[model samples]
Target: MTTGSATLSAATRRSVLLLSFATFASMAAQRICDAMLPELSRTFSVSLAQAAQVVSVFAVVYGLAQLFYGPLGDRRSKFGIVTFATLSCCAGSLMSAFAVSLDMLVLARVMVALGAAAIIPLSMAWIGDTVAYELRQETLARVGLGTTLGIVCGQLVGGLLSDTLGWRWAFGLMTLLFGVVGSLLFIDRRRQQAERLPTTNTEPVVRPGFVAQALIIITGPWSRIVLGVAFVEGAAGFGVLAIWASHLHQALGLSLSAAGAIVALFGLGGMLYMVVARQLIRRLGEQGLTLLGGSLMGLSALVLGFTPHWLLSLPACLLAGFGFFMFHNTMQTNATQMAPKARGTGVSLFASALFMGQSVGVLLAAGLVDRIGSGAVIALGGGVLVSIGIFFARALRRREELMRLQ
Candidate 1:
């Protein structure tokens, strides 16, 4: 290989790695907050519903902020945007550590969520610019692993630290990590800029029609169906875990730590799907995989709903987790392919749908748990997922036929 080409490749690899780490670490903060909420609620003498606002506010702000970040990445420097976002996360984490009231804590979580939300879109966009389409899934798979592993680590670490040292220390340590990592990345970026030559008359690599691209993904050919599946799939997987610790504690007499571990196992299923999804995609195609994933999620939810046994529910959780990711990944992968011109906006729109689904899922589950029961609420989610999948299958078939005609 040529020396300059090899150097460029190495630089790109390093950048992707740094961004991936930043993304994983930022996301870890999200779930860890869940573990801390109960403690905060007790300290502030707030109801569980009131304390849950911490997560609710974070999810909403995080999803909404992506709309801004996608355009920022297109207009400004990605490295600068990432560094700035990480700084915000660091500030939020430190502030939350010292928060004296539930209101202050919820505000702090919003800061962290807003800061961390920028990482994924920027990283994925950066990767899209660097990698070819054919090999993108392998790279995406690697990034997906980072996200899922972060979920697992967040649960395990949040519970363990909250149990051993106290919840405040979790936020404190996260603040330290964010501060250190953000500083290091900023320094590295400066060093790279100093060493590299400035190019003259460079054109914008990302297209200007990012908003249109976002709309297309949000409202395109069978886009609603695809996004609907993404939402339901996200709700079934993310919604359950978001509320499950309390549900298990109330229904089956599980401790928070034990529940966290069980949730960690469920996350492992997603990690496993990330590891093997490329092969599955190659063999099944997107539609087939979505159907298979949706069906499994439906079956798992049904099992969890009807069985009432923890052991049985465990495997059901695993299947549901795996199915959730498989289906969600299909939509995201397709979205990325859909608008290569505005990849950041496209993927961000996809994330917006998924997160929106999650917010609704958690809120809906929380409300329904008292009236319909956890089992029935989850079964309802599973039913929605299955219906979305069936619809998606038909839509994909029509798209394929149109492609043949074209």
Candidate 2:
């Protein structure tokens, strides 16, 4: 509820930095298949939507696994759980590199998703515990920068590696990245135990069961609002973006690698937003950010979807990324505060809502792409996101009055 940054130790700062890297790797693994979807389709002699099980299925497994990780984080050591989880991804990535069939690849991704499910949400929960509300948004932004950059690099790596060295090489890179980051995390945990350094987390003395904690969070009106918005955001925003590279490849006759490189600009735009997040947070406030951010993204999506010129797409994707993150970061800040008493469970529930939406969005968008065309599906997603933004902004405007009444 207040600033406790003064109590933040140097080791914790190091931990945050390490966690940032972990988040980067986690996010990178998620999007690493985006640009490779087309390549996988060709390799396995399947349809685009079928090849997309790599992304959609991973999301399903990832979202569901959060239910397990949420309560485990509350009862055990978050950092320790994260360390083990991170290491576990290495095995999955390695398996993916050797996958002989589409189904095998999907199974490998499930293994990776099972590990990666904990990385981002628990990292946020850990920050909520250690960093007070006053500093939470800024700290979360630091972690977010890693996340955004991962998006950039993931698209690039997936595209470039799949095109040149072979699609398996992308997973090879993940195997290495996860191995290294996970090891660093393990070492940090060991150091903390060795020196008996204090961390901010203390297990709740009278903590309820996971079901009760979840009920407490889901029962709150504002918490429900935040979760609902997250679901829609995942569906309309992140889920549909998965197809942008494929759309460009098929629609514009661009190489899959080139299309991916262009789409990677979206993440670069998010990195730019992170650089200026403090200014935006202070100037626009949450309501202004949501309204304006959604509008910008909607317009940009319309441009990116419709523009025939590949040159125009660069800026379109960039602006879309910037605006989407502006909206998303605000949602993240609110989620962190939604049920601070059960921060891990609350954040995981929020994540579940999000990735579940992602799974639905991918299936729907992919299914619709063949009928209406990818561009139309994309434009529709953009429109839905705009409506979500407007509704959320209005809800944010009334948040204070609503909270007081509650």
For model 2, how does the per-residue alpha-carbon lDDT over 250-351 read when each residue is reduced to its tens digit?
A: 999988789889999989988999999988888998899899889988998898889989999999999999999999999989898777668889899999
Residue pairs whose backbone atoms clash in candidate 2: none
TM-score, candidate 1, is 0.86
Worst 10 residues of 1 by lDDT: 1-10
Per-candidate TM-score against the hidden true structure: 0.86, 0.96
Clashes of each: 0, 0
Error of 2 at 32 (Å): 0.7
How far residue 386's Cα lies from its native spot in candidate 1, in Å, is: 2.9
